[model samples]
Target: MESVGITIRLFGAFRKFGNGSEIEISVRCGTNLKELRVLLSQYLRENDPKFSETLVVDSAIANDTKILTNDFCIEKSCTLAILPPVCGG
Candidate 1:
């Protein structure tokens, strides 16, 4: 299976992992945002027992330009940001 390299920029609660900013990972060529979320969740659980998969699921995936929907397919190498939910008044 062909794969592509992707960089995930951490935000909010997810910033606590690795270097506290970004993470690089490989995913299948046609992997969509929703599938990527599951892959990320698995990665976190394996890397850190305390990592919360729920956070990953609730996070928004965005590229350098804009936020992508769950069905958006990643076709090439790129940088994506994980924007976790935030609550403020």
Candidate 2:
């Protein structure tokens, strides 16, 4: 299987779901962001339930200005920003 490197950066409350900083995950080339979430849940479930829930509900995995790969294919060496819903002004 062709593989690509993905760096997931979690912000705000979502950060608690990960091991701090960024996580480098290997994904099959053409994997979608939704698929990426499933992969993350496998790892995040061990640490925080809230992270999994938030990832399902509030986060959007995007590539720069365009929100490609929400269900589209992911490219090699792409960076997905895990943005959770923000509260407060």
Model 1: ten consecutive residues of lowest lDDT = 10-19
lDDT of 1 by residue, 2-21 (tens): 99999999888888876999
Clash pairs detected, candidate 1: none
Tens digits of per-residue lDDT for model 2 on 18-47?
Answer: 577667788899887678778877767766
User: How many angstroms is residue 59 displaced in model 2 relative to the true structure, after the best TM-score fit?
Assistant: 1.2
Tell me the number of clashing residue pairs for each predicted model.
0, 0
What's the TM for model 1?
0.90
| Candidate achieving the largest TM-score | 1
Give me the candidate number with maximum lDDT.
Answer: 1
